[model samples]
Target: MSATYDVYIKKLTTQELGYRKGRLMTGGYFYISKSAVGSFFKELDKYVLNDFLRLDFNDPLEPGNIIQASYVYHNDKYAKENGTRNEYRIYHNRAIAKHQLHFQPYEIVVFIKDGDDNYRIEHYTRNDKAYRILENIIEDSKIRGQHALLQLSEYNTLLNV
Candidate 1:
């Protein structure tokens, strides 16, 4: 299994004293490899926006910049959004399974803005305590929404996976 990392952006808030504070915000999570991270940054530099600079994992990121990145492998195989509709129709040989055979990341290009006004992209691997804290924050925020909480069984399954 590939390593999963929790990605987030620090939202910056300006105070009356001309200082800025950063608040942790969810930018979604993904299961990706370290090499993929470098490739992603390369693409981000080549394409995306003209003003946006390429991320340097060795150094710090720039503030007030936007990162348009997505979970690499997550996609609806039969959807019309991309070219998958035709590909699935032509190659599908069996009934679609209810459960996914592999992990499907939350497919979305998480747009992260340096809210702290500091040039840094915060990321935590699965083993970090900060990862757990951010996960709790995400769960709490979701609970506050209209959706019902995940059942204990489902939560357990997620943890095991």
Candidate 2:
């Protein structure tokens, strides 16, 4: 409404989209980009750094029903010790299995932070009008190869962060 806003737009990769093994959705996780993760979230009080916390997210597609996702964190510190740097990733959920969220590879996944642990998630393909609008709004410079954390204002805002 005003000028600046907090938003995360990710152009999904094939691995990020997961595959359908004869109708079974397998091997996909909603990974939170560190570039986009600023102060959008409050203090990490809901879940521990290295723990599985059940997250019941609101899905507009399924009215009166919430999709579930396990919030998981793999700290960067572990990367130094031979683990991994996937600090913010949400996996092992029922959203895909239950068809609560529709998505595909190369489509963009949007995260508009309404509050801590609360966001309006949207998926858009390249052919979508909304995606075209976003294409004009999200500048080429802001994106890092495939994905980048982005923010837009009321005027289809586009600028380098």
Candidate 3:
């Protein structure tokens, strides 16, 4: 869709905060942060690498269309040995290929939590309003980049939802 918004608010992802150059992460798996995500993720087998929670997302970029993704939580012994925090990953190459949802280096992906197991995913460039806002937050609060959970909105309350 390649659309830019001076004020853009789309569906959310790993929602809030931002990711940087290494979003593709290791392998083709794309990851995000997990919060008070409710039963969908909460019930997932957190320590089981093979266990996954699924969601069907309505892509905001392409209205009225649904994209399916398989989400997995990594919090097992392997994760601890790797010194990684609890995180969520979506098998989204299908979404990327089918709907052109590419997360290039220094780009932004906003995952909006919709319901118990629903979300609105958004994409933006580093220079776009989304990235700039998160960038400012990162700079101002010294939030680490590249998959660091954005600890926003206690004092900030940046996005309405």
Candidate 4:
């Protein structure tokens, strides 16, 4: 069977960000940001905005629904709390994404920024158990010394329209 996921873009309206304040991702809410948003847009069309939508929702997001809100936009603080310090050592440090729903076996990693003015990635799995499975991917990447390639899929927010 083939795996599938839900993906969409959320337009970042001037009303959302406003002239001075940028958007922020509240606890579980999706908010806009000033710094990283630009980059997010640049890569929005290639990466998975939300979670892996196709991972069967036996438990369901809500009480009866099969699909749950798996992923969401991450604010600076929340990202810092869940992510490693080294990963977000840049001027505007934050995790690009977060897994809000529970879906086993699948792991989601979102890289934001690094100290060397590079990039930082976030890893979000179905649960703690999947960490090991994801570790290998990370290890292999590190061992191969390959730079992670992130493309734009569909952003939860739309920057242009």
Candidate 5:
């Protein structure tokens, strides 16, 4: 079944850096760092403003889904023996020609549902890290058959959105 939700993005406060810190459109506040805000806007300008971003939420893991988001896998054996090394693997659908340039690992990816009812990767981080937290969250969401809502608190966990 298809679902619709009212999504809003807000800058988070520094004091509470752990929690998701946002309400369901009520009176609660969400906090994000100034640098994060700047990065988000910069991504927006590059992706949304340039019309490269689209939101197609048919099924993130489905092969038919045009947009695919994944993470770079760091093999422990390779890392320990050969020094740090990583490999990017597409988690959901296979990467097509259109998404070859954008779909990558170690980035904070934001998948949105566009006006045409298509899904796309909106935002992502540039740096690659050992821990693919976002990719894990997305995989968990697929397993649970629900949207992933990341909780950035002391006990960082993925909540169903």
Candidate 6:
């Protein structure tokens, strides 16, 4: 049985502008200056909008950034994209049958900073369950011949031996 799931990105507007907790130094950073705060809000707005735009469409299984990695397992090999490789640690396990029945959702956070700092998009998996869900989603998609979207030449690279 095959099922479909929708992937969406939501806007996050809470800025963590605060204290440093340590043995000797306890300090707070405030967004007091109007210009600094205004500029920060503008960047946040753009970041959120970009995330929303990226989720406008549907994919059978979106492998997040893993699809860009060079994956080789057993007898299969998947070429890396953009000269980058993905590395992950499987902290827990879930039954593949149950995971296949329920698709997973991916949450990506984009941070924007200026001057010496630049913006970054961060991937967050809230829990081990969420991680399994996503792993199963990508696995199920591969089993159904959906790896073409990721440009993965073979399927064995993602299988658990």
TM-score of 3: 0.57
TM of each candidate vs. truth:
0.23, 0.66, 0.57, 0.20, 0.22, 0.17
lDDT of 6 by residue, 1-161 (tens): 22211121121112211122512222111111212222322222221211111111111244222111111111111233332322111011121112321222232221222222222222334564334543454445433221111111121233231
Give lDDT: candidate 3, residue 47: 58
**Candidate 3: lDDT of 56?**
74
Provide the global lDDT of candidate 2 against the true structure: 0.57
Question: For model 3, how does the per-residue alpha-carbon lDDT over 14-74 read when each residue is reduced to its tens digit?
Answer: 2222333635333344554343223123446655654577777786668888777877766
Minimal lDDT window, size 10, model 4: 85-94
Candidate 1, pairs of clashing residues:
12-115
Backbone clashes in model 3, listed as residue pairs: 11-112, 11-120, 12-111, 12-112, 12-120, 13-110, 13-111, 13-112
Model 5 deviation from native, Cα RMSD in Å:
18.0
88-137 per-residue lDDT for model 4 (tens digits): 11111112212423111224434432222233334344455544534543
Measured by TM-score, the strongest candidate is: 2
lDDT ranking from best candidate downward: 2, 3, 5, 4, 1, 6
Give the count of colliding residue pairs in each prediction: 1, 0, 8, 21, 14, 0
Candidate 1's displacement at residue 113, Å, is: 2.4
lDDT value, candidate 1, whole model: 0.27
